[model samples]
Target: MSEEPLEQLDAVDFAVIAFHVDGEWDVDELTLDHLLDAPTLVAAMRRLPGEDSVALVAVDEDWFLVARVVEGRVRMLLSDATAAEDWDLAASVLDLLGLPEPEDDDDQVPAGDLGLLADLGMGAEDLGALIADLDLYPEEILSEVAEEIGFGDDFDDVVGLAPADHA
Candidate 1:
């Protein structure tokens, strides 16, 4: 695959901001100027009003990113580590995690904290399994993730997706 720099937020398929507060989960679309910039995405999540805030981003239908900010600390996960070879967002995510950029020979695997959402409900094993399923698309993987984390309906509503779409 050829490297294609993501120049703007418009290149992203969807960006959703989800938060848990007052024993309820809230979801909204994240509209930012730099959605693919890891630092910018994290900062935006931090500015949201919630005890726990997360940003779910799908880029070009090629990969998905999950960024969760809690008390100013950020944890991130990229669905396909090898996407760094072609995507600036994935490359930035590798930088944020202090990981080396994937080489061409590297396997297309997930990078960063698979356990990022463990406290919320999904464990590392489950997340790894989901990402391992190459038959699923980025959006489908993220949709399952949202469902596992108790924000399925909210996520679908905000992203204008229906469960049947994944079917």
Candidate 2:
């Protein structure tokens, strides 16, 4: 949304998305490029807080399984992180803002992962398999998933991961 709709959004609407189910975080673990993608996601993920957190399983370097808990039901927020270039993220935002959906784009979400997969709570292996099916890699998926869920400042070691700026 062009403006923050904190009032319009309920705590349930505020999904605490995690990069992994194992439970970890990184300070400044997010980037601006990723922030641009959240609006659309926020729109589709309207249910809000269940386990108080969700996860993003990276199927590849670019794809992710953004799973969240809502009223005991799970919701998936899958996406091709690369599609932000063409306005998929922004469109999702507009949709959430109650704005009109943009004409046509390459950012359409597929059938299966569009909503929660099952009613029964899954075990670690099941969750892990879901992540594996989504193609999650610990380090890489962790980073990508972190960005997708808005965990920009949870990690303090971010600068250490990048080169120091030279004068």
Q: Largest lDDT belongs to which candidate?
A: 1
TM-score of each: 0.89, 0.28
* After superposition, candidate 2 runs with Cα above 4 Å error: 1-50, 80-150, 155-167
Query: Model 2, residue 102: displacement in angstroms?
Result: 21
**Model 1, 17-118: lDDT tens per residue?**
888888788898987554747997887887778769988999888789999998778899998888887777788899999999777636888889999999
Q: Which residue pairs clash within candidate 1?
A: none
Tell how far residue 19 is off in model 1, in angstroms: 1.2
**What TM-score, to 2 decimals, does candidate 2 have?**
0.28
Instruction: For model 1, give the 10-residue run with minimal summed lDDT.
Output: 1-10
Best by TM-score: 1
